[model samples]
Structures are given as structure tokens and as C-alpha cells.
Target chain A: MSTVVDQPVARAARRRPGALSLGLSRGALELKQFARTRPYLIFTLLFPVLIVLIFGAAFHGDAGGGVSWTQYFVTGMIASGLLATGFQNLAIQIPIERSRGVLKRLVGTPMPRSAYFIGKIVMVLVVSAISTAILLAMAVAFYGLALPDTATKWFTFAWVSLLGVTACTLLGIAYSSLARTGRAAPSMTTPVALVLQFISGVFFVYTGLPGWMQQIAAFFPLKWIAQGLRSVFLPEEFAAREVAHSWELGRVALVLAAWCVAGLILCLLTFRWTDKD
Target chain B: MKTLIRIFRRERAIVDAVTENLAISVRGLRKAYGRTVAVDGLDLAIPRGEVFALLGPNGAGKTTTVEILEGFRRADGGEVRVLGTDPRNATPAWRSRVGIVLQSTGEFEELTVAEVVHHFARYYAGADDPDKVIDRVGLTEKRDARAEKLSGGQKRRLDVALGIIGRPELLFLDEPTTGFDPEARREFWGLIRDLAAAGTTILLTTHYLDEAEALADRVGVIARGRMVALATPAELGDRRNAMATVSWQGPNGPESERTNAPTAVVAALAERFGGEVPGLTVTRPTLEDVYLAMIDKNAISKEEAA
Candidate 1:
């Protein structure tokens, strides 16, 4: 029974593929699965646009330093969109995957463990980019906002958005380790994200908040990301409304980069592929 | 005595040959969760292309040992090798040769069965054809159906399909048929037999003795974190030498006696009843009976140790 059957099967085991291709396929499958979920699709694509429209219409006057409320609100909602797609969504999705045994099943496979995480990161980036583009398009079409006028401003937008997404996604994966079950994931993640959004100036201007609140907001990546986005889209004179009456682009970049490094270390230490207990 | 000697020689030769091609080997394996010892001083050796069934009661460390072998958990202390590599430090190349069917169903919400199977196929270098594997598991009809829509048995079949799609040389089945109906279980058993026939070594942990008897070439019975017995299904608990029971209708209605020679007892009863002993029957211990006895003996030993 052994000799006759062993030869063919052993010969068939010789063809191993590259991990990159496998990761790409996994990313593609994730995107397809996400597309099929109606509620998540609607929320991720429309929530930011809804926030921009509602806030832009309600606050009709200028925000500060001659920047119209519509422009300020558009940039803030874009930052909020990035946080929603990259951090909040992943923090909830990962724990649900663990509780459902999907992550456990993936761990049992021959796939490289890094490939699984890379696939997830890739999916988050792609989804966030799509949602960000949609939010920008809505802002430009309905709110009379303009796209970044110069290549330098576009470059700044590119790096700032990429760093922000990477940092938030890593933080989300790290935070997912705290969730014990799929049912508990929303309760675990939503309150924290909501608090961060409110305090980091997603819904209001950070400089107008109290001194203590501004100090606290300076520690997180969201505030820096929002400030960076404002520098890209708002008028140059609007920098007067920021802290110390300067754009502080260098400080924004440095803080987001530091958060990216810290979030990566936290993710490496805390992210669990399965529910071991 | 001559037959016994020949059988002993044959078994030794088989062991010697298998030792050179062991798919899984363990020595003095120990694992504990905080204060509870799950596997203690456990030893095992499974040969290539052989289906080895590990039988035990709940919390007997069967699952823990299998998880360690599958590289899902690290052992506290032991020498362990699966597919000639230490699972604790196994590379992705080494993992490609091993397949695992876990006890719980894997949930891939909103993903079609074909999509999930096809995605997993890309993970392995020389995976089998996903459509063919789907057909083999009898899920071809539901290939495009979402995973959440599958029945319990269908979900199990999908698990098997994924486990085998890699064309793994060593497959781990952890209670693969736990929720299967009778017919589904028989079908699943047939699928396992086909894999074994194709020279895929299988390490199975199951609570069902009937499954062990039907599928395993050798069965290891574990209890209280230790292997109490290891033998072929027919030879477990010395079932062949164990006394059988003779029963018949006597003057007192029904009579039964335990004896080494049931044929002799039945003959005496026939003579006592003139020509025929009404309702005469001879029965040997079933696999379940021997298994229960072994468990009881192990429990007593554990109590004595404590």
C-alpha cells in the first residue's frame, strides 16, 4: 500500500510558489469579501462624506483666519475617513476573524505568517485609499473644495496619508488582541476610536479646545495627520490658526513617523493570529 | 508458540523499517496549562502512510499533543519531530507537507466555497486542483455558495477539502467527524481511507472507538495525560485472550457464564438441554467494552498515584 502510492504524491510536492503572489491573492480575496458586505461597504464609503456635508452646512461662517468652515470640515472628514477605514475597521475585523476560527485556520496553513499580515495591511491601505478618494471627490464636487494645486502639496499629501494609514492600521491590529470575542469587538474598539476622534479634532478645530485637551491631542497621530491635511488643502494664511501660528509640517511628519514606529512595535508584540485561550 | 514467535519477529521487522521513515516521533513530551498537566511524559511514533488513531477521554491531552505536533502550540518540554522537522521551529517549506483539520469549523463569512479553497491553494507550492478537491469532498454542487450557508456536515467536508488541497504528506485530523451524521461520517471515513491509500500518513485524535477500530492500523489510548495502552484495535486490552460470555435458556429461564472456551461451555449446555440449548449465544467483548475497561483501570491508577 505504501510504495505504489508514495511515488506519485511525492513527485507532485515539488512545485512551491512565491509568498508575494500568495499574499496578493489573499489581499484580492479580502477585497472581494469586503465588497460583498453591504453595510460595511456603505459605512466605509459614505460616512465621511455624510459628516463633511452635515458639518459644512451647519457651520456656515468662517472657521478661523479666513478659512471657510466647508474647507476645514472637508479636510477633517478626510482624516476621519483614514482613521475609520484603517484603524477602527481593522480593530473590529481582526478579533471577529479570530473568534470565528478563520485566523486559526490560516495559521495552520503552509502560507508564510508574514504573508497573512501583509495581505491584511494591503487590503486596509487599498480600502482606505478608495474611501479617501471618494471623500475628496465629494468635497470637491459639492463643497467647492479644490485639489492640492502644486506637486509639492500633493507629495506632502501622499506621504502624510500613507504614514497615517500605516500607523492607524498597525495600532488597530495591536488593539485587536484585547478583544475576547466577536460580540465584544465593537464595545472594545468603538469607544476608544470615538474618544480619539473627538479629542484629536476630527469634529472640531484642535487649537480652539482647552489647553489640557490640546496637550493631550498632541500625543496621538490623528491630530498631526489632520494638521498635515489642512496644510495641504487649506489656504497658506490658515497656518495662523494652528499652534504658534506656524504650519509645523516638520513636527507633524516627525510625530506621525514616531507613531508609525511605535505602532509597528506594538503590533509585532501584541497581534495574535488565533485565540489561544 | 511458533506462531507467536513468527508474529513477534514480523512486528519487530516492521517497527525497524518504520523507524527509518517515521512521520511523527515524540519522546518524554510534557505540556501543562498553569497547574493542569495536559500531556506528561508521553511518547509516540507514527510511520509513513500509516493511519494512527489516538483515543482518549476529554482533557486527556490528546488535543494538546496533536496541536503541538501541528505547530499550533509549543510543547513545554520534549523531543518532537513531525515530517522530520521540529514543529516548534518548522519553516514554511516544512509546513507545506502537513495538513490540519481542526475540531472547530473555520468561518469565512461572505466567501464562496470555491473562493476559500482557491485562495488557500495559492499558499502551497504544489497544491492539488481546487475544483477536483471540491468534487472529492462532495461540495461541487455548493462550490459557489457562501461558507455561512453551508450545513454542519458540508462545513466539515469543506474543512477536509482544504486540509487535503495542499496534497500534504502528513494530515492531522482532530475530531474531524464530530458533528457529522451517520452517513456523512461513513463518507468522511471513506475519504480518509482514500488519502491513506495514496500514502498520506494520518494522525487522528477522536472520541469514537468505532472510528478507531474501523480506520486505524494502530490505536493509542491515553488517559490522564499518559498513554495507558497502544496496540492494534483487535489486540487492544488483550481482547483476543479475554474471556467471553456464554448464555442460554436453562431450567431457571436464562443463564450466563464467563469462560475461556465459549465453544466448550455451549456444548455442555446443549447436552444438558437434550439436543439443543434454546437461545444459546456466545459473545466476546466489543471494542467499546474493552475501551471502557481500559479507561476505568487508568482512572483507578491515577487515583492511586494521587
Candidate 2:
């Protein structure tokens, strides 16, 4: 055995390109793992669409403020889908990974911590994008809703969706720090997500909520994302149902961007790469 | 005889070089959780290419020391250098040169052994071929099996494969064979031997004294957050010169004596019996005996101090 040590081989050479390749591979693996989990895969992709279908069919008449019930509910469900992918999925997954010692194992490796984080963010973006597309398709095909027709409306959808996803994903990562174990993550995050869905108008008409409740919802990203999506897909006059009686596209963008920054800072402060203190 | 001289010269030169350029060096390393100290003013140095085993009872700071060396945790006080750089500030290149096989498997569910290894390979600049690493760990037959489907020992082998795929200059194994069966433990020891043969410096922490005796060129025992003993397994507790025990069967039943000259005692017994003594046996203190004695002494002293 000692003779083998005498060969004097050079140590392995280090390469910078490996980090990016590793991150990409990690993202791919996360996606593959998610897909292999049959229940999670099915629920993540189909739940929002199911909610939209059921609600749109039940509330087929005009939903006041010049918006059809189908259009209104579909827009809300799209927001819900984004929230599910960005916030709920990541909040649960990160804690599970930590508890399982997956994050600790990665920390032990030469893979840069930033690479692991970026890989997770990339997976969140991909899954959210796909889930959003599925919800839109369900809305248009089954609920008789029109797609974003104008270039400006598509543009609004693009930036708003991007900002919303970024904010929720960061928030999710931050929220994961509150969970002590994988088993505790669902209880920690699910109630918060469910509460946000309710007050942010995913399940009910936002305009009909109490004044204080509306003010409470205004502080969160979910409400702004729903409003932003509605502005893109609903008729122009439908903005009358919103606070300030307008789409408030500027405010929506500003609020979402602010939340994105806040979430980033929170995650930076609170997010742990491993379960250990 | 000519080959023997060359090997000796090469080995001596390598040892001299590494002793001058230690792979791991620590001084006054201290860490405390609130009021309880996990590591207390401990000092350690391990030369390159040495398989140094750390032995300790539970919570004796072995894991804490290994964690600090691996850069997984920071010390409250003291200087630590692993591969000539402070682990706290070590860059990605530095990290790439270190490998850690943690006590728990990484549990990369749903991915095959080959896939996980290939994925981890990308994290290093010049990683070993994933297939070769798989075969090296003796997992070629189960290379296609998902990580979650693997048996306990197989998972440990996968952990080692990932740890060495990057060809680390320093490898840390923390109680790596806790759940492994005896056969599996032997297999794991063989893998460790192969890595050491290839000159990968290893810092292994284990509770098993036999394992330390089998694999470590030198062993350090820690107790109460401090190093109680550091020596080669044979030299620990001065076991080489420690009194040996000789036992023999007599007409009455059995007799045993602890003596410095066991061979003399056995000969005297042979003469007295007028033939080979029945059921005579000679034994020295095993590694386990030395280890237990060292730990017990430390515990007693600590209690007295408190």
C-alpha cells in the first residue's frame, strides 16, 4: 500500500467552468426528482387548473366591474399557481433537503454555495413557468378566456410574472429557515400560503373583502401579482373593481420589485445552507 | 534489496517534506455551545498522506474538531489551517481539494448511483471518471439503482465515491461505518486503504478501536474536549511495554499472572509441569484495552478537577 503513495502523481487541476456545469446538473436533477415523485408532480401541475375549472364553471355570469367571472377566477388561479410553485414548493423542499442532510452533504463538497442556491432558483423558475403556462392553457381552452392580445399586455405579463416569481421564491427560501425539520415544514409554510391565497383574492373577490383586510393583503406580493395578471387579461374598465379604480400598473411593478428586494435581503439573512446552526 | 533501498529513501524524503508542510495544523482551537465547551484549547497537526484516526467517546469534541477542519463550522478561538489555508476563508479551489464523507448519506433520492456520481463529478475541476469511481467503490453491479433503494452499506460506499471523485488532497470521514455490518466494515476498510495508498490524507473519526488499529498510522484520543493521548496505535498507553498477562490451567482449575516477562513465566510453568503447560496462553493489552484505559483516566481526572 505504501508503494502506491510513492508514485508522486500531481493533484487534480481545478477548473472554473465546473461550478456552472454543476449548478446546471443540480437543477436538472431536482427536476428529475420532482418528476419521479408521482403525487407531488401531479398535484403541483394540476391543482391550480382544477381550482380554476371548478370555480369558472360555477361562476359563469358577469362578476361585476365589467369582468366575466371566468376571466376573473382564471387570473386569480394563475396567481395561485405561481405562488404554489415559487413559495409553497420551495419552502417545503428546502427544509426537507436540510433535514435529510442533503444540504449539509452539498456543503461538504467543493461546489460553491452560490451554485447550489442558483440551481434551486433555476428549478423554481422552470417549474413555475411550466405550471403557469398550464393554468393559462386551461383557462383559455376550457373557460373561453382570451389570451393577452396586445403587445403591451404581453409585456406587462412578462415583467410582472418575472418579478412575482422572483419575490415568492426568495420569500420561500427565507421562510424555510423557520422550519426545524422536514416534518415541520408543511405546518410552518402551508398555513401562511393558504392564508395568503385567501386574503390576496385567489379564492374570493378582493374588492368585496373588508377594508382592513384589503389593507392587510396590500402589504403582500400575492395580491399585487393577482392584480397585475388581471390587468393584462381582463378588460380595461374592469380595473374599477381594484383599489384606486385603475390598473395601477406602475404601483404593481414598484410593489413587486420592493418585495423582491426585501425577500432577497431576508433570505440572505435567514437562509441556512445546512440544518446545523 | 536494491528496490528496498529506493523505497526507503523515497518514503523518508516524502515524510520529511510533509512534516515540514503539514496538511492540517491547529493551535488553541476552542469552541463552546453557550456555556459548554465542545473543544477546549486543543492542538493538532497531521502531516500530508497520513491516515490519522481520532478516537473519542460521544461529545468528546472529535466531531467538532473534524467539522472545523472540514470548514463546516467555525471555532470560537484558535487558528486552524487545512492544506495551508484557513478553512474559514478557503476559496472554492481550496474546497475542491477537500472531501468529506459525512456520517449520514446525502440521500439524493430518485437518481441512480451513476447519475449522482456523474453529477457530483462536475463540481470538481478534474474529477475522476464517474464509472471508474463507481467501480472503485465496488458498486458496479448496483450502479443503475436509485440512491433511496440502496442498502445501508451501499449508501456509505456511494458517500465515499462522491467524496473521492474530486481526488481530494484531504478527506474527512466522520464515523463512516457506524451501521455497517462486519463484512461491510472490512470492505470499507479496504477502500480506505486504497485511498491512503494513493496518498490522499485522511482524518477519520471513529468509536471503533479495532478500526483505528487496522487503518491509522497514528491515532489521537480526545476526552472532555481535550486530547488525552496521541501516538501510533501500538504506542498508545505505552502498550508495547505494558505488562502482559499469562494464563494456564492448573490441577485446581486456572491461574493467571500479570508480568513484565511473560516468556520467562511461560517457561517456568512449562518446567514446573514437566511438559507443555495445559491451556497456557500469553496475551498483551489489546488496542481496546489501551483506549478504554486512556478514556477512563481522562474521565477520572476531569471529575477530580471539577
RMSD of each: 6.0, 6.3
* Runs of candidate 2 exceeding 4 Å displacement: A1-14, A56-60, A65-68, B1-20
lDDT of 1: 0.86
Which candidate number would show the highest DockQ if scored against the true structure?
1
Total clashing residue pairs per candidate? 2, 0
lDDT of 2 by residue, B213-233 (tens): 999999999998898899999
Per-prediction fnat: 0.63, 0.53
**TM-scores for chain B, in order?**
0.91, 0.92
In model 1, state the lDDT of residue A85. 80
Give the per-residue lDDT digits (tens) of candidate 2, residues A1-277.
3223333246565564655666777889888988888899899998887777788667767888567787787788888888888899989989998888888888877787778877887888898889988988877887677898999999999998999989898888888998988999999898998998899988888998899999999999999999999999888888887878998999999999998899889988988877774
